[model samples]
Target: MKKWLTIALFIFSSSVLFAQKSVKMHPVIDTAKAKWGKIKIVNGTAMTSSNDIVENINLSKDYSLLVTAIEDAGLTQTFKSKGPITFFAPTNQAFSKLPAGEMDTLLKPSHKYDLNYLITYHAIAGKLTVKDIQRKINANKGEATFRTIAGVILTAKIDVNRNIILIDENGGESVISNFDIQQSNGIMHIVSSVLVPKTKVL
Candidate 1:
């Protein structure tokens, strides 16, 4: 009888542990997982293979300039933090689309503050996936405003083509090219353009 009781307790404990492991902490992540179907696995060290944001960024060919700027700005430790940050990373082509010498100017030592603001404007504090963004847009009646670490607001909306567009304070628009690049500490989404925040959105 005691042996049967011990066996039952062990089964109950194992079942409880399994149930806990199966459940996620956030409903948004769960919904995003379902909506997106599967977590994408890439060949390079871009997203799934790497552990942190900087590694993924450094390994990506598209994000070469961005990674260099991040290092120059001295934000490597910040990116390496144990945060579930959501980063709207812009590609090299996006940086190229900037004003003729804007990229060069921002990289200068005197323009570090500007560069930091520019980069931080692309990041949010949480792991907000594509589905979370969609939900926010719907809840806000087609537009959602996200406050960034740079102390600015970025507006987001879904276009008619079902692509998500991020509108910076300066009115520059960036389309989300790749959605949900997961890292150990955060998530990164590739955007087609760089975002610049205005002093205020009028």
Candidate 2:
């Protein structure tokens, strides 16, 4: 009888230990499993691989000019901080179009404020998708005034044939070449021309 009781007790203790192990292991697996659908793995140091805002910008070759301009203007840290900023980033071609030596002059330390103002003038406080702009334009009878973070008001209008155009303070127009480059904190819209704010808009 003693032998039988001892075996039974041993079995019960082993079962309890197994149950505890199972409980702990099960919870770990449950927590480790992703609830969302299968995630695709992105390889390499490309911006499209990550959804992080600053990282994505750093990775993108397309925004090299914009990135250089931002660095030259000393606004890199400012932009990296807590921004769901809408950046109207100009491409390399756009930057090349600047008047002879203008780009070089803007990059100088003395012209830091001018560069900052120009760059920040292109950014808005929130992440505005192209759809949002369209909606706003529709609501405003096909014309909308978008106020930039730099205190400049940009005019968005749809032409008679329905092409979307962004008119600068000087009445020079730039068409949004690429729309909705989404990021974690904001969106980037690639434009053909650099936007310069007018004194009145500033």
Candidate 3:
């Protein structure tokens, strides 16, 4: 009788432990995991996503600032459009590299057009993979230029290390930190810095 009682208690304790571990999940974490789906690793460094561009940005760990900027610019629907957009998404650290109070100034309601232009300047129409950009650079004699949706020019080149580097119209340089994050509507390449427009939008 005592042996049966001990076995029952052990089973109950194990079940209780399992239940406790199962309940130790946060809503935000769970939601992010659900939305991101499976992350496919390529070349043991790059990651491909299963969600759309906007959903990937919203669910990403490093794109919260970009998400907020998109919202502030009122370009959420623009990003969600059925497009083959090639977005140079800047990480939070990239946004932090801006001059003091610059992002704050851009985020103001009065500067919505400027913010929109700034964000759109990072996006080019059509889905361009890193290989595509590299081929363009080769075809253009080691430099290629693309016009963004905001009507700004972005130059691309392959560095000595073979990393794709983007030069904005203002001569700001941002290297692609991560490439080929595939989405349903397009692809995103993570950039190391914010690409400022040559002139503020009116």
- Over 97-175, each residue of candidate 3 has an lDDT whose tens digit, in order, gives 9999999999999989989999999999999999999999999999999999998688999899998999988788999
- Candidate order by TM-score, decreasing, is 3, 1, 2
How far in Å is the alpha carbon of 185 misplaced in model 3?
0.6
TM-scores of all candidate predictions against the true structure: 0.76, 0.71, 0.77
Best model per lDDT = 3
Model 3, position 134, has a per-residue lDDT of 92
Across 1-202, the per-residue lDDT of candidate 1 in tens digits comes to 9999999999999999888877755557778666543455443432552468887777668788989889878788989899878998887889999999989998999988888888999999988999999999999999999999887889999999999999998788999988887787888888999998764333
TM-score, cand. 2: 0.71
Candidate 3 is scored at a TM of 0.77
Q: Arrange candidates by lDDT, highest first: which order?
A: 3, 1, 2
RMSD of each: 10.0, 8.0, 7.7
Pairs of colliding residues, candidate 2:
none
Q: Write the residue-wise lDDT of candidate 2 on 1-202 in tens digits.
A: 9999999999999999999998987785455334422222222333331253455666657667778888888888767767788877777788887788988888889988788888888889888988899899999988899999778798888777666688888887888877677655577777888888865433
